[model samples]
Target: MGNLKLFIGVLVAIFIIIFLLLIFLVYKNSNMKKNISFLYTKNIELFKANNELTKDKADLNRQLNGNDDVFSELRLALELDSVVNSLNESGDGRKIGMDKKLEGKFVKSIPNGVPLNFKGITDNYGIRIHPISKVEKFHQGIDLRASVGTPLYATANGVVEYSGMTSSGYGYLVIISHNFGFETRYAHMQNKQVVRAGEFIKKGDLIGYSGNTGYSTGPHLHYEVRFLSRTLDPINFMKFNNIFYDERKVPWQALVKAIDDF
Candidate 1:
């Protein structure tokens, strides 16, 4: 009887040990799974953050390269006080303010280079003797003397408002409407069969050939700058430090030489 009792006690002890071992293994496996799950979640978050930072860096690079949109530049120039202060120091402070105000009155106005190549004034704005009429009259535009068939380009981006011959004076006329109450007219074109009405044109796009068309007496371009039908002196706008010829200038040999220097 004593031996049987001792054997039973040993068997119970072994069973208890085995059960405790099984319980410990189950707890350890659960904790390992929880740690692995936490590591995976953390890794995913880190990857997402890295991608966002890379995208932000790319955007900053584009802005530095001046590839930002025009509106963005204007907004930045307006919001940043440093830009305003610099323009003021450069003597263009008043002009910048005026430009902003005029933007509302007139259509969109952007710098479109120079009206003519740098050259001596042949016939300046104001009163001048008409080449064809041979009578002294108010010259609304300036004339640049160029060889026949010289390439003519638009001063700015605009839509063709009118493209036809005028019996009053202009021949082979091409009028571009730069929205904001501004329009430009090119007359005495040699041939403008390439451009049509209602076509979209960009600044510096070739529009026609220089010629002595309409009532013109010589191979030159009659360029006019008008504000809501009122003609303004084109020279006032061309008096910039850096100037280049557009469709409005006569493209004289002397003008071409001067432009090369510019």
Candidate 2:
């Protein structure tokens, strides 16, 4: 009978130990789940913070690019203004500094001076990427950086062949026909031109005002020099201090003969 009682006691002890082990396992599982939930919440918070940082970085970059464009425009304006003021003060009325020998010759009709008072050329005559379109193409003329309402002058004596707006990207355009198969084109002028088509004009006469018209990215004057209907670099003709002619491109000998015979 005692052995039977001892066996019952042993069974009771085993049951108690198993019950305590089950309780411990349940507590451990609950703790593990709580830890996993906490880690998941933390990961979500970190992901959201990363997204906010990315957005802030993009905004900063955009602001910097905008400021750069504004700074470039301001610098161009300052340079143009300084040169224009100096030229205006040096000359009598609209007579710019020109070579004295070619003052009364047919060579005088050559557009050998800058049409606008700009210290630098932004876009030269060649292949370049269009600012707005972002496509590589040929630029047929030089771009003189100027602000809106800046004054524009004729580069030489000529008759206005055409002066008005156009379907082309030149905006308000002006084409002048000069002697010796020479022509000058001015583009991106503000609204209507000061001169009309078929009107006679001297080298120093006012043509129009600068503007950001047509396909331009900003305000500037697009100047072109053409010989025999072929486009030439406008910068080669913009020698204000001396007489310059490209003998390779222009038949100066034949032109001089024609002028001398006339």
Candidate 3:
């Protein structure tokens, strides 16, 4: 009877040990499940944030490509003396009033180079706030930052249409008339311009020097390019081959034909 009691006690102890081991395994499994759930939730949140960043990047790129004028600041005036109404009441676009003699002289009279050696660009072409007026307006040209007396060059082979002081805010300016209805203007120039009105000039010819003249906060060259009196971004002409002429409503085909025929 004593031996039977000892066996029964040993069996009870074994059962108790098994029960405690099972409880420990169950508790460990519950903690592991909680950890896995937390990791999964954190991963989902990170994925959502990454997606939002990608979308923002795409939107910013679209804005840059679609509207270059969206970032324009500081106004530059367009006051060319010879500019006529490019578009008539009928909206007939791009009337090329080329001087036959001038066209014959220069077949390559297209503005395709930087007007001067500029350190950098302070303002780009488009709508922007006028520094003096503090009001929004259309800026017709780009402002190239350069020190006073920096030598300016003719961007194309053309005849000087105007070269003198102007009360219209571009203190001393020079406008060159080229073939294919294209024209280039250099503004805020020093009082002494080497070229005069009706003088023939070739591409890269020294025209004048930059200055702090007329509506300017500092010494800079305000450069402009136009086709039939319509303002075009000077940047496009600077990289002449890369100009998106179609989007800017210029007659690329006519220009090509004129050049070819000439």
Candidate 4:
């Protein structure tokens, strides 16, 4: 009876050991499965990150290529180019200083030399009291005082539109139409030579001679510039034409100061 009881106790110990071993094996397998799942998720994320980086690099390469169309690379680039071109086309006041007009623009030119008085300016343009009449009135042009027989010059290249003694105040009026809406007139001339109706005259060419033929206080040349039959300030045009002066003639210190201040 004692031996049978001892054998039963040994059998119970073996069963307990077997149960513990099975539980340990099951827990180890569960941990391995969880680790595999985590690794799969990380691999997917890395693949996505690599794909995005490759796309970004390709875009950079396209932009760097010189052969690529300027409009390509990005939609925003096309918009920026359009805006810059528009600003340059507007011209505004800068175009006058730069002398760079927009494409297809027909730019006119300023006339050369002083008009009217041969030695100096006797009268200016705009409204002023008439020296002879002594009444407040608008002066249409400038008066240059000079002696008779002084050679008159064509202000610009143009064809003679009219040349004759005027019924009004002009003694010997010569009109040269430069087309492009620009016309120049020389009045109070002593003689009309080298110019006639329908004759083309070059710039600086002899057109007439100054005289006191017209109603005037003294001998003078009346020069007028008209655009489409409307008078303009001849002084302004002369100043604009003065842009091509010699910088060497200007004081170097003044030029340097202007640049520095600007």
Q: How do the residues 106-165 of candidate 4 rate in per-residue lDDT, one tens digit apiece? A: 112335455433787788988899877799998888888899888888776789998988
> What value does the lDDT take at residue 142 in candidate 4?
84
Query: lDDT, candidate 4, residue 182?
Result: 71
lDDT of 1 by residue, 48-136 (tens): 99999999889877765667754344344343323222233335435466433433221124324454442345577788788667899
- Global fold similarity of model 2 (TM-score): 0.58
- Whole-model Cα lDDT of every candidate shown, in order: 0.66, 0.77, 0.77, 0.66
Candidate 3 stretches with Cα past 4 Å from truth are 1-107, 244-247
**Can you tell me which runs of candidate 2 are displaced by over 4 Å?**
1-103, 240-247
Q: Write down the TM-score of every candidate.
A: 0.50, 0.58, 0.59, 0.50
Among these predictions, the greatest lDDT belongs to 3
Candidate 1: stretches off by over 4 Å = 1-108, 115-120, 240-262
lDDT of 2 by residue, 69-131 (tens): 543444444433343233433445654443222334643577877787764678999899988
Better of 2 and 3 by lDDT: 3
| Candidate with maximal TM-score | 3
Report the Cα lDDT for candidate 3.
Answer: 0.77
Writing each residue's lDDT as its tens digit, candidate 3 over 156-251 gives: 889999999999999899999997788888999999969999999988889999998888989999999998999988887786543533234564
